[model samples]
Target chain A: MTNTENAPSGAEIRLEEVTKRYSGTASPAVASVTMTIPPGKTVIFVGPSGCGKTTTMKMINRLIEPTSGRISIDDRDVLDIDPDKLRRTIGYAIQQAGLFPHMTVAQNIGMVPSLLRWNKKKLAERVEEMLDLVGLDSAVFHDRYPRQLSGGQQQRVGVARALAADPPVLLMDEPFGAVDPITRGNLQDELMRLQSELHKTIVFVTHDFDEAVKLGDRIAVLGEQSKILQYDTPEAILQNPADDTVAGFVGAGASLKQLTLLRVRDVELKQEAITARPDETVEAVRRQLEERNRPFALVLDERDRPARWVHKRQLAQASSLRTAGKPIGDFVSTQSTLQDALEACLAEGGAAVVTKERGRYAGTIDIDTVMATVQRLRDEAGVSE
Target chain B: MNQFFEFVGQRWGSLLFDLYQHGSLVLQCTVLAVVIGVGIGIAVYSSPGGSAIATALTSAILTIPSFALFGLFIPVLGLGVQPAVITLTLYALLPIVRNTIVGLANIDPAVTGAARGIGMHRLGVLTRIELRLAWPSILAGTRVSVQMLMGIAAIAAFAKGPGLGGSIFSGLAAIGSKTAVDRALAGTIGIVVLALVVDGLLVLLGRFTTSPGVRARA
Candidate 1:
């Protein structure tokens, strides 16, 4: 991952003392912002409305010229390059897709490549390839105009158009802000999948903290005048906000949101629970539970999968382990999110059974373990509860 | 009516010639007006002050009575096609210029921004994106101009310009003479019939030229 500094697919962007002062304005629009965006990472700029988050992202591609600052990409000064030529090399996508109404989907996607004077045959191939990459069927969508498509479909075309030329850097300004929540989630997932393979240096701007956490590899929480409150991984930001403003932006369910970021596999499972075959006599299970000094024991079936939970008191009414205690109601796999684990743990009202491949009894995650895991994350982030 | 029909049959050759000239005059003037109007629109659409001035000037020309316009042009330019072309083209400019300005101004800035974001230069955005999207409005303006010009070109004949207006004026001058009413009715009917045909052709042109995405809305 350290070699990502010179990743072939994307180029690093650096902004140094970038400030934009609109004439007659008392304060600069973006006042002295400096940050280095690593190559091949989706770095998000999240902030409240009119906080200059969008203005910062736009400056990267020179859409809004920085009044006085040096901005460089891959160590080459962006201001040195011709603005239009530089823009052609940087992919840009915005909300509502902004596709040309007169052009078909293929035309919109092919515009930049065609501008670069790619030959007709190659340009045509690239358009089809781009459409396919964005999960659009060329046969159906290639000839269709932007208005003919649905909102989500239009956004897909917008993304496809931006990526058509395979620019090393992509600047997205709230690209998913206009879509319905459900479609927006699907689009975010699709973008994540695309980024995994493409690895373009993406500078995304959004006011939605949840969206930033969901999509960004590193989220830069911006404040007034494009101030960088916290520029770190989502995990770090959620667990430990930089200050009161950032914490307020993170909102009340910060730890709850943190749970969604973690998975069951990442945490230690409680594997020392006493277990017995369901066919064994309930007297032996009760004796084993007493020997282990535990209030309950898990009963495993023939193939060693979890079958039931036998309480110390329930063993008196049952003659055999087969008829002992109560059936295991719900369980989570090792791949489940900690949030899902917590839900399952709460539903079962005790230690939640953790399963591995094919529902085999793996271990357990009790309520205390779930609480402690979140506490451990907070501790690691140097943030107190 | 029977006398008008008999007169048309007798003067069919001359009437057809008048119709052709009337059509030619309207077509030429409309094309000229569109060229100038769209140019002014493109130049001024981005500037509120310029657009307002251009629109006001074109509209002022429209308020001038047609006969008075002909009289004003006659002293400097005299009669015939020169006055007719200038007068007719001037009168047609209001709709074309206004529509062009409105159409160009109405284009979504986001669309133009996206165009520039994708590497289109200033002229590229103007010709390829802004103009194309605003074309529907521009074309509608042209349609209105053409309709207005069809009637206005008849007035141009008062300055001794070519077209059916000459015949209508002659019929009025020769009132109570045999076939005078027939001649006047012939000129009136010919202009109406020819205006419809030209408008239909313009409609067909719109169908062919306009993008389906825009056409769907219209």
Candidate 2:
């Protein structure tokens, strides 16, 4: 087992003019798609059905042989390795889950480990760990058969089984597509959380662009017959769509799609902040800051230069205490992403204060920042009319 | 009424008495024939592309004049039950072999893929998945073969084997109404009962063991 500790920055997945043609076909199913996927990042393949997204994924593990071109994993050529060995090293998940009907959940998850001839104790431990990793209770599900499980439960088991050996690379073909929308969201969230922790190089194939945008670190927007339209982050693709096909896929609400992708830097944050004098009564400050929902109330020195941050928490606490006089200064930045800004405001009981250099008072971000971020991201994403 | 009572009281009385006398011989022959026929069926069915060859061979065996085939067997294996049992057994193979091939071939490819993907090797897959799924069709074929065996066992008595057919053959030689009609009727009725019983048993077995999916579709 090679330690990926110094694993060369990002996972370098390279395809040099890769193409696949079935025995009878005149044209390649996947035409010379040469792309590189950065390590520990998700690269999504998006296109219509039969456009060879699936074929391209399978070629990575040699489930389907590529007619031409070389594929390199890390730095080694993959064609020289045995197919089964290569597949075992690469975790594979499919749309149907494809669990064996007769096997128990534990045995199913333990398949690759057992194939690798792992010790009984080690295999058993791995199975339990995987079941827990997929948010399934190992005790409840270990002994149950596949037939006893529901579609969503079975899909979790499928993920568990693929990840049983803890392979560094994962290839998923619409893994959550079979589940209901609500369950799909839950699974996607779970997968995202897992990816953050494990950092496995992932190649995901899906026909759903929304799912692609939701999950992909970088998406390869593919056109008919496996043409690479654009390979970019969801933000970049939304902001500067390559063509009508790509724009159409981002949909009529491309602006809304941008909100999903755009970070806090793309939205404006107030830099200058108004301050209340330190000697001012808490009541006076309350009257100034209450219901207005500013990110912070700044405490000023005698000259009214930047002093400290008076977060909304101090005001709310002061109101409860009925204290006459107090200085307020403790808050987070307004420049954080809407997610962080919203969290900070909520943390300070509906309004967070910001601090600039050396704890100097700065403006805050509230729900208004969130709305502005959404609107700006939408505009920048190219919403016509 | 007096004549009927006298007939009942006599040592060799009704058709039932005649059937009872020779039933063991036919039962023995049927059992041995089934075992031999099933073995041949398995062997031939498992052979690659042996279906057509086996079917033609069985068809030819059925066509050989039954009494004449018995006579030919007697010259080689001597008289008595051996020749009769072997001939009847050979006749039972066609249906069983044909059905076995059909059963094994008809399993779902998707199910097979699922089995293989889970790392079940060849024999494990065959026994646990394919063979179990194909069992009902295979049993149906065996039922047809067993029913045919019951009807053919009576003809085996011609070669001095003690079957119900012996009584019929004896009656034919005698050419007299009194014993001939009684003997011939006894053999015919026994064969019908045997066929009915075997077919009924197989039907019950099929119901008990067939998969719910297969049973519903069937």
Model 1 Cα shift for residue A287 (angstroms): 17
What is the per-residue lDDT of model 1 for residues A1-385, given as tens digits with 9 covering 90 to 100? 3444444468899999999999999999899999999999999999999999999998888888999988999999999999899999999999998999989898999999998999999999999999888899988998998888999999999999899888999999999999999999889989988998889999999999989988899999999999899999999898778899999999999998888787889899998889899777778888888887998889998988899998898987888888778999989999787988999999999679999888888899988888999888878777443
The regions of model 2 sitting more than 4 angstroms off are A1-12, A262-367, A371-385, B1-218
Model 1 alpha-carbon drift over 4 Å, by segment: A1-8, A268-336, A344-369, A383-385
Quick one: best DockQ, which candidate?
1
By DockQ thresholds, what CAPRI class is model 2?
A: incorrect
In model 1, the fraction of reference contacts reproduced equals 0.67
Model 2 reproduced share of reference interface contacts: 0.05
- Lowest summed-lDDT stretch of 10 residues in model 1 chain A? A1-10
Candidate 2, residues A1-385, lDDT tens digits: the string is 2345644233568888999888888888989989998888889999888888888888887767899999989887889877666777777777768775556789879988887889999999999899989999977999887768888998899888888888878888898988999999889888988888788889999999988988899999998668899999887787788999998887876655554554444555565454677677767777767657565666666654445565677676664323323434335543333555565667755555555555555555666766777666558556642
Tell me the whole-model lDDT of each prediction, alpha carbons only: 0.90, 0.72
User: What DockQ results do all the predictions give, each relative to the true complex?
Assistant: 0.65, 0.10
Error of 2 at A199 (Å): 1.7
